[model samples]
Target: MFGRSKDSTAPADQAPALTEEPLGTVELPGGKGRPTPKRKTAEAANRRPLVPQDRKAAAKEARAAQRAERDRQYAAMQTGDEKYMPAKDKGPVRRYIRQYVDARWSLGELFLPVAIVMLLLNMLLTSVSPELAFLGLVVLYLFIIAMVVDVVIMWRRLRKKLAAKFGDAGQQRGLMMYAVTRVFQIRRARLPKPQVKHGDYPE
Candidate 1:
């Protein structure tokens, strides 16, 4: 028992060498030898510049969108939808101006088409007879004065109303011009088309 050994252990250096299996040259589907990039970088690399023809197509689409917007605005003006109205057509002041104009009858309302007719008539008269044309001119000037006076009267009343309502609102910049423009437009043809009828004044 003293001369014999019961068991024996292997030496550390002589133990089996552990070998890791080689990962068999893994390849990316389409990117041989390339590093994998972030999503945004990959997307940017795929984006193409717009050529002339592509630009034209984009412009056409833009124009179509603009036309659709214009049509919507026109429809809103016709129906008086305050939500989608143009700047000039929006606000309580403009609405009041419309009511003021629509509440009364004015010869100024017929000024546009009538002035065109008068101009043509004047031209015709001028070609036929100078004296008749001169007379026509005088009459035309008088009519223009009357229209001007009508607008002035309208403006005076509008100013008073605006002062009473808005109290010197800085937005009154184009209010007179707005009122004058509306006066030139026919009542039935006014945009945001007159919610009030004749004789609905002093409100």
Candidate 2:
């Protein structure tokens, strides 16, 4: 029975050899030789030089042309025998006087509006009470007196300044007095005019 029994698996003594074959050579679109790179020539490396001499000459010519134009203008003026007067150079004193006058004028211009606004405010407050109304009236009167005093003071100061600047000419003084009186329109005695013509009036 033992001899007839199936043979138990016997271990193989030799292992199988692996057969490896090299892969087929890949064919590129072109030949296997590497492509040659393009080389730059000396002529290609050399660039044209941009000289700015022409541009500089053009600028110089422009300046000369402008000078010629100015000279021509002066020559034309001379040929025409035109009399040119330069603007007056104001001295410090004159500048100060002008500035002072302008400031005073500006103050005068603002005075009326400011006074009116104050009066309106006073009136608004007066509407609340009779005492306030009376007080407002008194304040308004005081304000008006102050304004008159200020104007008189300014006029006197201006007159003094003018006198200092220009010595008193009797005629000028008289004219100035007339002008002041006219400007203020204050009640005064009748004055005679240097030039007056009596003409017959048609009835």
Candidate 3:
């Protein structure tokens, strides 16, 4: 028949051929190349105990660490190392002040020992002689006044020198108190121990 070609017409009972293609996976750039970990698995891997299992051992280790730190700081203070110095003792100005104070002799340094001797004498004399005990008290008062006077004189001179050198920074707040406290402390006992000797003032 001239109605249609044999290839163009399908048999009534036969099925049509599939026209769709098979799907393939697409690879993305910077892929992890592995499956993502589950939440529980990730959490477990990251978890750490808040408290240490060995309490005593942990405490001991902490104390040892603290002691080592203290020793390091102490040595730094002794050697006048700025990096390890406490905030109050740090800086060039404080260093200069320390040197200036160290170079001079303050009445306050001897005040402690002298006061102790005076107290002992007053105690002993109180029972033996009232007049002498009174005299000891008077002497102690006079010594204290002398210490005050010496500190005032030192500060007046040091202030002028500091102004001439460091300008405004040399006269920073609390520096006078810092110098005063240093003058009272024994030469060997001062922290950031004296870098200069007698008559070796900072220029």
Candidate 4:
């Protein structure tokens, strides 16, 4: 009768009762306060690759590379580095002579009519005095030569102007001279023919 009967169906040693306490308060790093979410930054918004900080240095390097390449090309063009053959010949002397000849012909064309007129005048003046005729002929020859010189100078000036205006091309100079000569010829031809007025009686 001391504590109970040991002859009962239950075992003598019993397990302790299992107790459920409130989940041990999960304490965060900053006490029980909620964690603040991280804020998004401007750097994160663009999401592009970061450029070099020293842009001037990069530009200078690029320029230096370009200059080096240019120098390399120039060195390649040099005669000592390679057998440099010119693309075309410079035939300036021949061109000058040709242009001078062309100018002479143009001048001759300009003065030929004047010479013819002077010769006709000399023939008329010869009827009065042989000396007067001789003098007139000499004067006419000088005048013709002066005219030729003047025309040549004018042509040279025009050629220079045209060359400056367009370019120093022989073909262009030839074409211009040809066109000018044709125009002069047409004008000369028209000058001799007198215009017939309306209702003019034929003498």
Measured by lDDT, the strongest candidate is 3
Worst 10 residues of 4 by lDDT: 81-90
* lDDT (0 to 1) per candidate: 0.81, 0.47, 0.88, 0.52
| Residue-by-residue lDDT tens digits, candidate 3, 89-197 | 8888888899999999889778888999999999999999999999999999999999999999999999999999899999789999999998888788888888899
| Winner on TM-score (2 vs 4) | 4
Off by over 4 Å in 2: 1-98, 104-110, 169-203
TM-score order of candidates, top first: 3, 1, 4, 2
- Candidate 1 TM-score, true structure as reference: 0.66
Q: Considering summed lDDT, which 10 consecutive residues are worst modelled in model 1?
A: 1-10
Off by over 4 Å in 4: 1-113, 170-203
* Per-residue lDDT of 5 in model 2: 34
Model 3 lDDT vs. the true structure?
Answer: 0.88
Write down the TM-score of every candidate.
0.66, 0.32, 0.73, 0.33
The local distance difference test score of model 1 is 0.81
Candidate 2 yields a Cα-based lDDT of: 0.47
